[model samples]
Target: MDDDLRERIETAAEKHALLNAVKHESDADVGAIMGPLMGENPDFRQHGGEIPGLIGPVVAEVNGLSNAEKRNRLEDLAPEELAEMEAEEEADDSLLPDLPNVEAYDEVRMRAAPNPNGPWHLGHARMPAVIGTYKEMYDGSFIVRFDDTDPETKRPDLTAYEAILDDIDYLGFEPDDVIRASDRVETYYDHARDLIEMGGAYTCSCSGEDFSNLKNNGKPCPHRDKDAETTLDEFEAMVAGEYSSGEMVLRVKTDIEHKNPALRDWVAFRMIDTPHPREEAESYRAWPMLDFQSGIDDHLTGVTHIIRGIDLQDSAKRQQFVYDYFGWDYPEVVHWGHVQVDAYDVKMSTSSIKELIDAGELDDWDDPRAPTIKSLRRRGIRGQAIVDAMVGLGTSTSNVDLSMSTIYANNRDLVDDETDRYFLVRDGESFAVEGGPDTAHPPLHPSFEDRGARDIPVGDAVRLESGDVPAEGDRVWLKGFGCVRRESDTLVHTGDDLDVVREGDVDVIHWVPTEGVQVRMRTMDGDVTGVAEPDFGDVSEDELIQFERVGFVRVDDRDDDETVVYFAHK
Candidate 1:
């Protein structure tokens, strides 16, 4: 087999296999490469992409594919298409629309508000990232509301508000202003009063158990017969703390015989004994239920559109009911399927992440192992990479985990050439050069103009890797410096003469001249001892580099003489 024919066959086989694994790409892509190769080399044979009259199917253009990749795509097509391969390639942009026709508005004048009982997590970030991205595209305003009326379970820290705000800012989302449920308490009371007057909502004196059982089968409470005047008085008493906690509850009067039990007579407000973190020990004991708060807020804000998870699909039905009672316009709601963590094969939940953190298995909320935005950022995963991984997954009604780290791996590979390389030494292992012949030090990333050649003087006593140091007559690589047939591990490079070397690696290890400054680094896994790359003192926090053969690294902190860094997971 001649070199040209052998090369073409290998390339064709690899392309064919990659297409098999790349579920997103079609076979026609393989023909682009094979056409040129088979035409140039007579010995090569092609399978797909040569049918007489069949035209090539159009495929969406995925971002980040190189021209060479585009060529490889041709080989996967039918053989007939190769003969008529002169068809022009028109770029596909269906995945992301130009959206010129979307009417832009400045502010949401609309309804469901954020659940602010906890800080934003990866799941919480999804809608906001999409909405915020769209919001910015149209210069629109989004309200950041604190759904704090449900004080049934309050965070220990009163500053839960600030923590949520901080997380939102960290993710770069800019809301128009802060909206709190407490601020609307009087507004809710007035609306509840009006609903009672209209007989659309009723004050229920039923116990928690009775209230739940009431939805199972329609039955009117003795208090349900009270006139609007009496119901308003009772609601005022409940708000005024005249009634003890849970003594009276307010229920929206949906159809009592509704088939969906969840849609029937849902509680609109209840009294909770627990003191709110924000409100402190005030005697105001009544609290608005989540459904009522969210529904009314979205309506009041004039939110024209709604996007939430499928798990919250019930929210749409319930919110629609609220609109029906008030005769208000219902907003357009678009729900997305669930996002799951590929490794766990379960929906990524903040509670699970917190559980891991609480167990001490993960370093912090932002630890790369936790899969939070901070964690991904710490891992050197760019925001755009996360967004891209999400965007291409075809949206379906069914829930599935689309996350795959390999997408980030593929992205990182494209930018590898631009990454600087550094030699990092492991503990119990280090290299020494026979110091005699070298002249001056070369740069860590050698320039292409100078190639990789160094001007260091010739040395006979130069050291080989401690591992590759020959037992007696083993050969080893001197790395970019060159290969050397090692005679012994003890050969230290003294500043004197040139030593000849050849390649034979048991394993290539790292080295630094005995005289340079010694530095210590902390990797994500553990502490490692390595010669710091020269620019380690000069590089900014955002800069990342490949630590030679070890892994990718980014310097996170510089403490006096010590450096703290994070290593990429293998």
Candidate 2:
């Protein structure tokens, strides 16, 4: 083939190979590149048999590049194709199975009811993520309900209400309406009164031990036979704080001999002396139980679907009695098994995390080591990554253990192109080079040259990790600078020839100027003190950046003395 034709064929092959490699995040196959290359350039079809031989070398070269490098090259060579591929992948990643009996309802309405004890953790995300997706799928309304009725036991924190909403918003599932069970004590009270009037509930003055002994044996307490008039009057007195906590509780009427003991005459409302966190609720002494309040609120708020853990299947059964009493339809419930994340050493519980924070072992809910959604956001993890990870788990009843690496992989794909690259060496040590260029300009982001580069002012010295220093007689290429050889404790600069390092097995090391800024990076493992490129200081806080040879980090705090960052992932 002529030189011009040969050059065009090779360039086309390189572009196809890079694109394929980036799409799969793996090595490119020569066979895969051939079809695209020939299809795009019909002239190459005539030389089809010889095309493989001609482009085999090109495919091999493209495959040899790292995933990031392949992506960067593809961005430069075929930006439109790369963008199209990314868009297709995103669409594929967001695919979800259609909800069962979705056509049964005129308008699909879902609710995410979170207990306002603390900010949401990774486990708490499944409800909102799944419900939010369903809401969008049916073009329906989404409600955020705070299940904060139990002000004594699972006490509600005043700050947790806003924090939970903020977390839901951060996950891109903004609620159409927000409801607090605490604010609706009167509504629950009215429902309780109606239930008593219908002979579906009664006030029980039995002690805890006596009630449990009776219920465990498939029997009802002494208050079970009370008439509606007497029950209603006793319930009113209970609501008026006529009895102390544990002295009386209103029980829903159900089959005492029910197979599931937990569903047999469950408690609907109980008297609690402890004041509620909210001032409005503090005045109300009687509070409705979770199943009772949520069941009533679900109907009142027009919720058509409910998503909860499989372990709470009994909750559905308990609420069914209440639903049947009012002649109201229960929302379609989708139960997912427990999702145990292997990301944290500590248990991913609000109480446990709060204990650590109170004990001074952790900073707060958003600490880098915490598994809360706020921590993930503070550590530079995107909301899309969390949503994608949760959605990929699907709505299965089988318990599943998730690794954080899956989230990290998902996040890497998102932040790779957006984050600029810089060098940061932990406990960096200065290396004096005999001679080299006075300045080096490295591209801010390898995939986007239009974003420009960082002007690194280099003198005769550069800083590298102390343990990464080359031994005597070892030649290493200082990235963005010329080659250098360590000789008897003295570093000597060689020539600035790219081929020299590429042709040989010379090691390429990332380095910053001796005058680089000091950085303290907080990671899951611990704090790592490092020296970063001077331009790192110019980066705005809360922006994600990749540390060359290190991992991704978010600028948490930037100051004149030193910059603080949180390590995201590799």
Candidate 3:
């Protein structure tokens, strides 16, 4: 091969090697870079035999530099390639399939009806993410409805009404309308009375055990044949607080011998003497069950589509009987199976998490250990990441086992370009370094040098985590500063040329000056104390940042005494 051809081959190999190294954070593979190198430079394919020999040294040189240096060199050598790589890494927000029969409806109105028992967890984000996506796709309205009617069992929390809305907003959705079922008790009562007069519902006074035995045998109770007037009177009496709790329950008439016995004569309304948490429903004792209330509200509010879990298929079956009685068309229903996240060993139950909080095991809804949406947001997870992760699951009915790494990957893409880099040595140990530069200039973000560099002042002594300290007689690179050789108790300055350290295979590590600012990072494992670069103090609260070689974190609190951050992911 001629000299010009060899130079072009080496240049192509170095570009691909630098890009691959920056991506994997490891040595570039000669095999992986070869295909892209030849593909991009078709002229080199004729000399494929000589290409590997010429490119091998170039790949080795590219792999020898630290991750930061690899990125810096890539930005300097082939900035357009770096930009193309980033564009490919950007999160694709169009993962969800189009809603079925979207053209059938004039407006695609949908609702996310979450029971306001507690704040929303990660599991609860799917409904809103899905519904919001459809709403945007069709230019329709999204309703935030609180299904908070069971005042006794799943008692409503007054504070959770706003908390749930706040979570929905954080997930990048704005409710076109907000409805509290507790405030609409009278509307449900009107529907209950109409259904009773229509001979579709009856008041059942059978004891719990007796009804269970009769229903198990596919036999009707004595009250099943009662006239509509008598049943309505009894229901009115129950609503008037004339009967104690569990004495009478309004049942929607259905087939007693249905294959799924749970669908037989399902309860519609029941008497609960326990006062509701909200004042609007405090005077009422009779409340509708979830299926009954949601069925009526869905139709009354003009909901054209329903998206829910497959486990609730029976809800659609039961509500169909009521829809038939009213001569109303049931909305289009889409069901998805349960999604299990591998990271959360704890049950993703609001009641269970509330128990933990009350027992003093968890700090609150925003605790780093909890799976609540607030916890995720507080841990530096972006709303867009959560939305994309949930929507990417699609509307398939098959149960999915997801890993948190999927979420972290999506989050890393969303945060990488914006978050500035800093150094934080956790459980740091001080070490003397003699004759180093007075100031070190590291790019705020290696990909975007236009953002400028952080002028971190260096001193004669520096600190690194205990595990990062080099053994005696070992040489290491003090990132962005210079190379040093550990001699006895101190690291003695050697040279500033990166090629020397790269050629010697010395480790490149991050460090903070002896007078660095204190930082306490809260991670899922536990709290870690450390020191960070002084420029870390300039970061505003809630800003996402990366600790040089450490993981990404969100600043929670910063003060002169101590700076607190939450570890997001590596």
Candidate 4:
């Protein structure tokens, strides 16, 4: 075959291999290559029998090159082909409408206010990508503000603060500033005092059930009528720790008959005696509620835009009351529907997940099965793929139900072009072969010549998967080698011509030398043990590789004897 035909076939093989990897296919079936190849080279439709002969050498050739070199060549030699592939990978952003008043601000300021109580999950992963895109669109500032004030419920972890920062950095965002609500409690307190003096809030001394009863009845509490002077004095005494927990709370004044019962006289501040991890222990018992604290912080931080879920519409309403009370303009609120990955049903709440983690139900925040960003990173999911997935969802107000496969699809497009290929044999069973070649060579990558090759010594005896032993008289091809017919534990050798097995429809399986290094792979469900090519023994920790016919895995641990990998996807 001519070099151009070989290159095109190699590209076709790589595309099919990547698609198979995305589908978690064990092997890139020859039939799989034909369809995509015919799309690029229509003439191949007529040369059906010769297709397999054309594929074997090209598959071997392209598998030797690094994913990066394959991509470069496609861009240089097959620009149109590469463009088509990229267009397929491009994110759909039709729902992400332009920001309101984009030209009104001197410089747009957007913030991702994640409460530093737990690591971020796929749902939370959307915030930075969405907010960062808005920031970049308007040449605005991207900020991270930790809303970590609810010590009793959504408790703060100092470690989670850095973990969130790392996640933000991983998503390719460099925040202009990082603000912690715990560090700005006094600022919120100041806003609270001003609101009390303005008669927009008051100190309520009613019990929880009593206030619930009155609120349910659409009646004001007895203390709701207290003058601003008396209420100010009561608040001062509560702030001085004179009032114990449950004895006092600050409630924002709103219409008692508001449509939403929770909105009628919402509690702005409450008492939480639990000592904060990062803040002083029980230094201030009275704390502002999320609505009050976030409302104050957003205004003071000069945030121009806020992107969050539709469930927070009530929060926006409550914060708007505070903004109106202070005669301040509310930031533009862009709310999207909640996104749930059907494959990932793990709790999205940091507090709940932290409880499980503390009880030892999970390995850590970065546990491969966990839904957190750290866990995704450990599983070999690329950050860019994450962004693409989120952006593809856009800012639609309609609910989105998806699966992990959506994210993996985007990831495969990226990782497939950069990852190298290797062979691995699982469920290995030994058998002695007669008359097979003494040595075999397979390209490290198929497309790049400089990637070199690995030599496998094909001795008389060979080990194959116990399940893959061909029936007597059946032909099988040992990858990188020619065909053989099964006869008991020995194989009758076939000619070296690639077409012999292609014409006979012989099954092909990957094999590793008996001397190949052992591997223990940690998959999403459990562990998969196998023997890999000796070339894999040199792979470093954190490097991603595709174990041909197995799956893509990230080297988690590399020792002198064996390697441990985290299975990313099929």
Off by over 4 Å in 4: 1-95, 279-282, 345-352, 355-361
Off by over 4 Å in 2: 1-94
- The candidate maximizing lDDT is 3
Error of 2 at 208 (Å): 1.4
What are the per-model numbers of colliding residue pairs? 61, 0, 0, 12
> Model 4 reaches what TM-score against the true structure?
0.84
lDDT of each: 0.56, 0.86, 0.87, 0.78
3 versus 4: better TM-score goes to:
3
In order of TM-score, best first, we have 3, 2, 4, 1
Sliding window of 10 residues with minimal summed lDDT for model 4: 18-27
- All candidates: CA RMSD (Å): 8.6, 6.9, 7.1, 8.6
**lDDT per residue as tens, model 3, 497-520:** 776543335778999998887999
On TM-score, the candidate that comes out on top is 3
Please provide TM-scores, in order, for all candidate models, with all chains considered together. Answer: 0.73, 0.85, 0.86, 0.84
Local accuracy of candidate 2 as per-residue lDDT tens digits, 1-570? 777678888888899888888888888899987777877777677778888999899998987888888988998998656755765465476576676677788988889888998888888987888888888888998999899999877999999999888888888888999999898988999999999888899889888889889999997788999999998888889888888898889999999999888888999999899989798878888889999999999999998888888999999999999999899988888888889999698789999999999999999998898998999999999987888778877788899776676677778888899999999988777777787778888889877999999888888788877767888888888888778998766568887587655334477888988888899999888799988888888899999999988999999997788999999988
Output the better candidate (1/3) by TM-score: 3
lDDT of 4: 0.78
lDDT of 2: 0.86
- How do the residues 351-442 of candidate 4 rate in per-residue lDDT, one tens digit apiece? 66677788887778777667778888998988887877777777889998655666676777788766788888878877677786787787
